[model samples]
Target: MNINIDIDFGNLWEALSAIGTIGAVIVSLWLARKDGKKKFQVVLKTTIGMRNDNSIDETPYLSIDAVNKSNIPLTIEEVGFINKRDGKKVTVTNQNFLIDGSNRLPTKTESYSLAMFVFNQEQLFKELQKKWPQGKKIRAYVRDSSGKHHFSKHYKI
Candidate 1:
């Protein structure tokens, strides 16, 4: 039996190359979105660790989880908090830590959580509790790797 090798692998190589690139892109997008979703997940029940009649200490315990899904890993970009008080909405700087693109979050995942303290600025909570009239509310903003808005939710507390 004679062996023949007349196949033209040029097109085959090109097709494989193109498919690889597209697969990589789709995987990258999936990973990015996954990372975005894991940016702000709570590890513990939302609670104000310490508080007083005149003051309160807020401690936020959170665990950020992201599935790379891509052939590459993702990095945590930024974190911020927004508060609306007395008809004025302001943005506050919050610290952040790196989150692992792997299914297993980093060891310091607990540290990624951020807590803020507000004396009477949290009138919204009071108002909702009927302690005060309609007032300001607190909201959280979450951004993704692409600098695009991903998460925005208002919390009375």
Candidate 2:
């Protein structure tokens, strides 16, 4: 026995058009989501010494800098480090020891600009060491005014 099935080219063209329309809709939605998401960058720096007039004095400190990479401006509410192992947070509130200290909290950081919080190296190190003696990794973080938390990659404690 022989069986012959007829396929219509017109119907096949319509089906392909439907698939293309669906794909275009999906790409549009994805791009919209990507554009709506917030973009904030965090950087960590350690200063072990300060050189002044042929003299390099020991000024060990850790600085957490948050830069607003998005078009909108955001205020940095807090900056700190968290132990990656146990989720322990160490917030540095006292600005007395900050290398470039701010007079108050929730400092405004404009787009493409940064706000830095500095902490005495020995002081922060001691506190973190006491909290997690065996933990060797930590991540720097900054909380924005809208309660959005932005974090950096792990750094060896």
- The number of the candidate with the highest lDDT is 2
Residue pairs clashing in model 1 are none
Candidate 1 per-residue lDDT over residues 91-147, each given as its tens digit:
223222211221211112222434222223343233334422344344544344555
**Winning model by TM-score:** 2
lDDT of each: 0.40, 0.77
Worst 10 residues of 1 by lDDT: 98-107
Candidate 2 minimal-lDDT segment of 10 residues: 95-104
RMSD of 2: 4.3
Query: lDDT tens digits, residues 1-157, model 2?
Result: 9999997667778999999999999999999887666667887878664555767758777877777887778888777788756778877676665664532577887778877777777877787788766448888998887788899988887
The runs of at least 3 residues in candidate 2 whose Cα sits more than 4 Å from the true structure, single-residue gaps closed, are 1-10, 48-57, 101-104
